[model samples]
Target: MPGRRTTTVEFVRGSVRGGRRRARSWLPSMFTLANMMCGFFAILVAFRGEYRLACALIALSVVFDIADGAVARLVGAVSPFGLQFDSLADLVSFGLAPSLLVFALFSDGRDSLDALGWIACFLWVACAAIRLARFNTTIDPTADKRYFTGLPSPGAAGVVLASVFAFADLMEGRDRLWMLLVVLVPGLLMVSNVRYRSFRSLVSPKSGKPYGLVVTVVVVLVGLATVPTVTCCVVAYSYLVSPLVVPVLTPLGRLVPDRLKEVLS
Candidate 1:
């Protein structure tokens, strides 16, 4: 026993061992619960007048929500319980939470509380419910995992949240009208057939010339950290318009492709 490690005889403490076993068993549920907690915390923040912080929580919730599913899939732990729990959490985080944020935008409106703005804010929830319902019903084995059928509801909510932060100062007196436009526009887009390219597939491909990408990422990070609200709005609005713009331009632009199309046609 001189230099060699000697194993010590230890008695099993059954209660302590069982407690740890139970805790480890509950890891996935803990993550799922955390997803729900994010939604609740976002609501609490919104009610407490922390609009930006509330929006940020919902955005984080979206990421956590995605991970919960991915984790379940990877671990082969998918269950009806988790699915229902996720849907409920999403309904609050992506639907109701953002709606309240939009409502706050009109709280300081010059005119009467904007009725249209209120409607637009809730529209996301309605559209989200519809989208989720459809998703549950249609289980396509052959569907492309790359692209979603319609714009995801979280993106819809993000557009509204981003607009709020982006134009925070501008929204002082114009809150009513601003919320009306931002909410309704993104809400309509969410239910539309317009297909937005999903960035989910962009994760794996590493560019050979990494320097350009690194610089691009650094510039973006700096811009975001410098003026988050404004940058978020610009980015969200750009994403909203892209799906609508690209399709329209593609067809018309295809009519004349600098003579190349003529030769091909």
Candidate 2:
């Protein structure tokens, strides 16, 4: 009787452990769902003519998208399920939502440029899909996660969002040609091989350099606060042009030590 009781207790404990593991696996998916929900809401709000608020929701979706991965890693919940789910959420949040924002922004133009704007937005969605598919199929476990092979969906969406926010009022009366360029350039870059800094290595918790991390984050936040439009534009455009600058600065880069160059880059 005593042996049977002990056996039953052990069985219950094992069952509970299994339950906890399953729960952890679903945790990241919840964040992914949150991301999708934000994107969906952004679309709804955009339909109601709340463009600024809709863009803000898309930005919020970006936060949820980031948190899902971070939580998955922290909880040892990384799985193929989480990866696929994240990609799908990204499609809606980064791909569809931004395209909707673009359409909403230019829908009233009623000109050839507006038609061009719509085409550009459609191209962005296609590129985003291609980018995600390529990323999933070619994910190299040993590859440098410090730099993405091309512009990420979130970053591309961010450029759109920041542009909308910065020039929401001015965009109406301005030449829509530049608007076409804004929508098209980031889309093209998504499908290109331009390397963008990932900033993942900078915030690695295992780095044992929290002071530097905190300082870097504070500096960025301060910059964002001061002249946000210029700061956002500079940051986004810098990533776009960084690859070009690398070759031009090769001579100066040669003067820096290899280790320092790696860190700076």
Candidate 3:
């Protein structure tokens, strides 16, 4: 009887351990799902004419997207499954959601002008898809982790979200010719050869200075709360132009090999 009790206890312990391992494996996927839900709901809200709320939801999706990657790294659960899932979620959140938001903002869907708006939005979606595919295919473990080959989809989305949120009233009143520039420029940058820095490198598990990063993030969050529109616009546009400015304003360009420089520029 005592022996039977011991065996049962061991079995229970083993079951608990297995359950925990399964939960850990699913953690990143859970976050990715949250990202997808935010994007999906954002699209729904955009169709409902809640543009501000839709923009906010797309912005919230960014937090989930970042968290999923960070959690995967923290738990050492990085897998090809996770990578593919993340990309699909990003397509919804960063690619489709933003494009839909922009279309909803600028189009009434019945005129020649609206037709032009639809084209611009479609171009943005295509660029985002191409950008994400290139990133997945061209990932190099030995390459400089500090930089991305093109503007990230999330960054491109942020540019659109920020601009729309900041100038919502003005854009509603004015001719939306400017919307073409906003959509097209970021779309082009996504597929461009320009190299932009990855903030991930700064707060990576390997980085010894995560505390400084945490403090900086807290400060930025506070700024976001106080002046959400201005802060978002500044951060989004600064990231967009950083690649061009970094090379000219700093000596980093000189460090690039001749072959790499051609591609980066």
lDDT agreement with native, every candidate: 0.68, 0.82, 0.86
* Ten contiguous residues minimizing lDDT sum, candidate 3: 202-211
TM-score of each: 0.72, 0.87, 0.86
- lDDT: worst 10-residue window of model 1: 2-11
Best by TM-score: 2
Better of 2 and 3 by lDDT: 3
* Residue-by-residue lDDT tens digits, candidate 1, 89-110: 7777777888777776576543
- The TM-score of predicted model 3 comes to 0.86
Ranking by lDDT: 3, 2, 1
RMSD of each: 7.3, 3.0, 6.0
The stretch of ten residues in a row with the least summed lDDT in candidate 2 is: 200-209
Clash pairs detected, candidate 1: none
User: How many angstroms is residue 187 displaced in model 1 relative to the true structure, after the best TM-score fit?
Assistant: 1.4
TM-score: the better of candidates 2 and 3: 2
Instruction: Report lDDT (Cα) of residue 28, candidate 2.
Output: 90
Ranking by TM-score: 2, 3, 1
